[model samples]
Target: MAERKLLAGHAIRRLRRQLGLSQVAMAEALDMSPSYLNLIERNQRPVSAAVLLRLAEAYDFDPRKLNAAAPGGGADAVRRRLSDPLFADLAIDRHQLEEWLAGAPDGAEAFARAYDRMGGGAAPGAAPDAEAAVRREIERWRNHFPDLDAVAEALADELRMGAGDLYGAMAERLRVKHQLSVRILPAEVMPGLTRRLDLHARQLQLSEMLDPSSRSFALAEQLAQEARGEIDALVRGAALDRLGERMYRRHLTGYFAAALTMPYARFLRACEASGYDVALLERRFGASWEQIAHRLTTLHRVGARGLPFFLLRVDRAGQVSKRLAGASAAPLAEGAGTCPLWNVYEAFARPDELLTQLVALEDGSRWFTMTRCVRRHGMRVGGVAARFAVTLGLTTGAAGPLAAAAGVALEGAAVPIGLGCRACTRPDCPQRSAAPTGRTRVMPERETGASPFGFAAD
Candidate 1:
C-alpha cells in the first residue's frame, strides 16, 4: 500500500497566521526556502517527515495535528451523526463530504452540532438524551482537553510539589485560599454521599468510606470547581443545552481532577518511561486503576505525547458505562451492548487480574486491549462493593512501542470480535446473540449449524 500524502496546507497557513510570521520568516524558522514553504502552504507539495520534525522543533507542534487527515475530526463527527438509524436510508458521498470538511471545517462542525441538537431528526425540538449528547461531545474531542491540561500545569507549577505531596498541598491551598474547612465524616452520617460542600459554613465534607486515593481525588475536584472561569472558557460555545451544560461541567470537573492528580508534563514523562504500566502508574501517582486508565486517554499534548489509547468501562452485564477514544479505532455505540467476546466482560470472572488480548474487529483492524475488574467502593471485606471492568485499547500501530517495552508479541492470531451482535457481520461467530442489522436470517429446517444464527451470505 502507498503511504497517504499529508497535504495540510490549510493547517500550515493557519498556524503561520496565528504566530504572526511572514512566509519568509516561517520558512527560515523551519530552515526551508520561502518558495518551498509557499508551495507547501498552497497544497502544491506534501509535507515531508523532515519538515514535520522541523516544525515540531520550531513551533512545538504535534505532527499529527498538521496531517491533513487530522483535520477531518469535524468530518468524523458528521459521519457519526449520519450513522444514526434516523438517516439509515440517506445515500451520502464520502469524497464530497471530505471535500466540504476540508474546505470549511468550522461549517462542518457547526452542522454536526446542529444535527446533534436536533437529535438527527427533522424536528428542532427532538433533543437527544442530555447525558448521551454530552458524552458524544466529549468523544468528539477525543476526551483530551488541552485547556484543562494547561490549567493543571499552571496549578502544579504554583504548588511546586511532587505527586506524593499533592494531596497535602491541595488541602493547604483550599484552607488558605478558599477559607474552607475540610472534614471527613463517618459513612453512617454521610450515607450515599462521597463529597459535599456546605457553603454557609464554608465546610467541605468527605465520606470516611472513601479510600485515600478517592479522598485525594475529591479534594482535587473541589479545587477544580473553584476554577469556574477556566471551566466556563472550556465549555463556552460547545452548543450544549442546559442539561448538557451541567453534564459537561461534571465531566470537566473529572478531567481537571485527573489532570491535577497526574500533572501533564510529569505524568506524561513517567508514563512513557514506565511503558504505561497501569499498576506502576497507580502506585507512583497514588491513583486507582480506573483513574490511571482514564488519565491515559488524555495524553494528547501537542509536542510531547504518550501512546494514543482508548479506555472503556463496562459492567458484568456487558453494558458500556463509559468510553473515551483517542482516535478512530472503533465506533463505541452509546447505550448499546458490547460483544461478549470482549475481555472487558470476561475480566469479571477473574476479578483484579490483568487480562490482555489482541482482538480483530469486523473491519479487520486489530487492537491490543487490557482489561481488569475494579472495585469502586471500599475494599473492606464483608462490605457491599460496586465493581466495574475497565479496558484500555490501542491500535496495533500505536501498540508497537509499548508492546516492545512490555515484551508482548503482536504476531499471534487475534481474537475475532465486533461492536455488538446487532451491528456485527461476522457469520461464524458462535457468541453472537442477535442477528446483524439489515441481514436476513435463514432458519434451518433440517439440521442446526455450528453457529446460532444462520444468515444468507452476502
Candidate 2:
C-alpha cells in the first residue's frame, strides 16, 4: 500500500499559532525555508515526516496527532452538517468548505461552534448563566486535560492503592503533605455542606451524609488543589465572570479529582478489560454511577482511550444537571437539545437500573446509549431524595465491543429523535411541547393529522 502524503497544512499552521510563532520564526525554528513552510501552510505542498519530527521535538507535541487522526475528518463533518435540510438552500460545495478550513481553521471552528450554540432554530437570547458557561468551557475542550491526567497518573502510582482504599489513600496524602486529617461528622454539624476544610484545625470534615463514593470524591477534590498552579493557569485563561470563574474553578477541581482517583491509564485499562461493565467499575474504583460516568468522559489521553462516551444527567423536571463528552461533539451535548424521547428521561421510571437503547439523531448518526437513575451526593441523605438520571452513550459503530451492541442492528431497533422542541423541526412528534420556530402548527379542526399537532412541511 502507498503511504499517503501528509497534506495537513491547517494542522501545521494551527500548531505554529498555538506556540505563538510567526511563519518565518517557525520555519527558522524547524530549520526549514520560509517558502517551503508557506507552501505547507497554504496546502500547496505536503509536509515531510522529517519536518513533522522536528516540530514535535521542538514544541513537545505528540507526532501521531500532528495530522489530527484523519486530516480531512473535520472538513468531512462540516460538509455533512451543512447538508442538513436547514442549510439545503445554501451553496455547500466541498471545495469552498475545504478552502475555508485551510484558510482559517480557527475561524472555521468558531463558526461551527456558533452554529451549534444556535439550539435548533431559536434566535440568540440572553447570556449564559455560570453553569452554562462552565459546561461550555468543559465541553469545548472535550472535558479532558492531558496535563492534569499525566500529573495525576504519576501521583496515583506513588500512592500504590488497594481496592476500597481511595479515601484512606488520598486522606493520608493530605495528612502527610498538607497536615489535614479526614474527619466524618454528623449531618447536623455540617448542615447543608458535604465537605469543609478547617485550615485552623488542619482537618477536613465530611458529613455522614456522603456515601463511600461521595466521601472519596470529596477527598479527591481537596487533594486536587495540590495541582493549584496548573489548574489556576487553565482557569485564568478562560473568559468568565467572577461567579462564573469561581464555578469553573470548582468544576476543574472535580475534574482533577476524578483524574487523580481514577488515573487515566489505569482506568482506561479497566474499562477496556471489562467492556465498560459499570457495575464492576463501580466496585473496582469505589465510584458511584455519576462519578465513574463522569470519569468516562475524560478518557481522552493520546494512544490510550476508552469508548468516546457522552455523559448527561437530567432531573425529573427535565432540567439538565450536567453534560460531558469525550471524543465526540454529540448533539445531546447541547444543554437545550435534550430530546424528551431520550432514554435518559425513561431511566427515571426505574431508579438505579440501567436502560440501554439505540437511537438515531436527525443527522443519521446512530448511538448506543445507557441511562441509569442516580442520586445527588450519593445514597438518599436523611431521606431527602434528590433524584437525577445519568446517560452514557457513544456512536453505535464505535460501541461494537460493548455488550449492549452484541445483537443491536440499527435497521429494526433504532428510535428516531431530534434535538429538542424549538430546535427540533419534527412537527409530527407527539411529545413536542413547543412549536418549532418559523413553522406554523397545522392542527385539523375535526381530527388530528399524522400527530396530535401537525405542522407545515419545510
Candidate 2 — what's its lDDT? 0.74
RMSD of 2: 4.3
Tens-digit lDDT track of model 1 for 209-318: 88989999999999996667868965773567788898899889999999988999989888878778788889999999999988988787656778878888887777
TM-score each candidate.
Answer: 0.79, 0.83
RMSD of each: 6.0, 4.3
Model 2 ranges off by over 4 Å: 1-25, 43-53, 56-98, 109-125, 128-132, 161-164, 378-383, 443-447
- TM for candidate 2 is 0.83
lDDT of each: 0.75, 0.74
| The candidate that achieves the highest lDDT relative to the unseen native structure | 1
Model 1 alpha-carbon drift over 4 Å, by segment:
1-73, 78-97, 103-111, 114-127, 161-164, 332-336, 378-384, 403-405
Candidate 2, residues 159-263, lDDT tens digits: the string is 764434666778888889989999999877887788899999999999887888888888888888778887887687566678878998998888888888888
